[model samples]
Structures are given as C-alpha cells and as structure tokens.
Target: VFFHNALPFVGFGFLDNAIMIAAGTQIELSIGVVLGISTMAAAALGNLVSDLAGLGLAGYVEALASRLGLSIPDLTPKQADMWQTRLSAHLGKAIGVTIGCILGMFPLLFFGDEEEKLEEKN
Candidate 1:
C-alpha cells in the first residue's frame, strides 16, 4: 500500500523536473495553464492504469495463496473501499501531473511572468 500510494508522487516529481528543465524562465502563463491541464489529465489516466494493475496483482497474489493452501488475511470491506478510493485519487493526481508537464514544456505559452502572478494570487 505504501508503494502504491507513492507511485503517483514519484511520477509527478519526475514530470515536474522534466518540465522545469525544458522550460525554465522562458515559459509563459498560457503555456503553463495548458501544460498544467494536460499533465493533470495524463497523470489521472496513468494513475488509473496503475491502480488497476495493482489491484489485479493483489488479486492474483491472493488467488495464488489460496491455491497453495496458505492462510491469507481477508481485507475488511471498509479497507477495500478505502484502498479503491485512494487508488482513484492517486490516479487523478498522476494524470494531472502528466498533462501539466507536457503543456509546461511550451516556452512561449506557459512559463511566463504572468503565470507567477497568477500563482501568487492562488
């Protein structure tokens, strides 16, 4: 679960770093907005994929354990529900980051002084 939760953060950090190096001070506000939106979308989609894969793997592991006659602890219904929720949230974050990074790379439109102003307002 720890690893699962950490995946999106790691992915987003990488995306952010890539964007910063690619754009730097040359980025504009419009480009930043576009990048932010795109990265978010992509991160969300990617997170969903990751969540599904993790769930699938967990299911497989449980099944294998059962087949091997090993005693596996059953997850509480609430725990399962919470896990799903967290997975969805992580996925959404990942999509956001992916979209943001891609759009952020546009120097003329995204990484501008106006963006800093907007950010300050937030």
Candidate 2:
C-alpha cells in the first residue's frame, strides 16, 4: 500500500521538476533576454507552465503508474482508515517524490547555466 501510494507521486514529481527545469532554462535564455526579466521570474513562469502541464497530464501519469504492476491492497473501509495505513501512504509519497525530483534534475546537466556564460562574456 505504501508503494502503491508512492508510485504516482514519483511520476508527478519527476515530470514537474523536469518540465520546470527545461522550460525555465529555455525561457531564461530566450524570453527573459528579450523582455529583460530576471532568472527567477523566468523560473516562476516556467513553474506555471509545468503546473498547467501537470493538470493536463495527471491522468496519463496515473495510467503509467498503474502499468507498473503495483496495485493497492484490498482493504476494508475501516482498515484503509487506520492510522498506520495513512502514515505509510504519506511517508511513501514523501520519499517517492523526493527520489523522483532528484532523478528529474538530470536536465540541469545539459542546461549548464547559460546565465553563467552570459555573465562571463559581459
């Protein structure tokens, strides 16, 4: 059950971070320069885009998670409401999202801080 609860959140965190990073980097490089916005502002806009994408893609993420062969345990309503069960689910989601966010940072390696380069050139 813990694994079950965690699985979808992993996908959510991964996509959220990955999209935010990639989109933010691009926006910072392109639109930010043209509009003279700060990097943080670009990042905020990128987060907005990522959040919108998350809303649209949530169902797909859930479907992918379901395909991973992890299923929720068959529990009675009372069993499902137990404190231990709820705790496990929460802990699972926390750990899973942490792991997935770390994994999603791979895009940073490729992005390589274009801002640093611009600063150095100036």
Candidate 3:
C-alpha cells in the first residue's frame, strides 16, 4: 500500500521540481531581466507552468507507475479502510515526494546565476 502511493508521487515530485527549476532559471535570465521582474516572480511563473504540466501529465505518470508493476495490494475492503493502512499510504507519499524533489534539484547544479555574471561584468 505504501509503495503503491509512494512510487507514483515520486515521479510527480521529480517532474514538478525539475520543470519548475528549469523554467524559472530560464525566465529569470530572460523575461525577468527584460521586464524587470523579480526572481521570485519568475519562480512563481515557473510554478504555474509546472502545475499546468502536471495536470496534463498525471495520466502518463500513473501509467508509468503501472508499468513498473506496482499494483494495489490485495486487501479486503475492511483492511483497506483501516486507519493504519491510510496512515502508511500517506507517510509513503510524503517521504517519496521529498526524496524525489531532492533528486530533482539536480537542475540547480547545471544553472549558474545570470545576475551574478552581469554584476561581475560591471
């Protein structure tokens, strides 16, 4: 049950964080500079993009999880409805997402700060 909930969310968190970071860096370097928007504003726009992409890609994420052979556990309806079961699933998802988001921060390693570069030039 934990794996069933956790695995797919790992993918979701990875995608969400990766896209947000990549897009935010791009926007900060380009549109944010041109329009004089703050880095935070660029990040907000990047989050918007990530959210829209998530809505479109949710099915694909689920399908990929299925392909990985994680099926729902064969619990009886009563067992599935137990509080312990629910708690395990929730904990699994939270932990999985945290791990995935950490992994997704790999993008930050590749991007340099454009503002720093500009400052050095001046």
Each candidate: what lDDT? 0.50, 0.89, 0.90
Model 1, position 120: C-alpha lDDT score: 95
The total number of steric clashes, by the backbone 3 Å criterion, in model 1 comes to 24
Tell me, what's the RMSD of every candidate?
12.5, 1.2, 1.4
Model 1 TM-score, 2 decimals? 0.28
lDDT of 1 by residue, 34-97 (tens): 5755545544544555455555554554454356554433557687579676676567557655
Ranking by lDDT: 3, 2, 1
- Which of the predicted structures, 1 or 3, would earn the higher TM-score when compared with the native? 3
Winner by TM-score between candidate 2 and candidate 1: 2
Predict model 3's lDDT versus the native.
0.90
Write model 3 residue lDDT over 1-122, tens digit each, in one string: 89999998999999999999999988988898789888899999999999999999889999999998988799999999999999999999998899889888889888867657955864
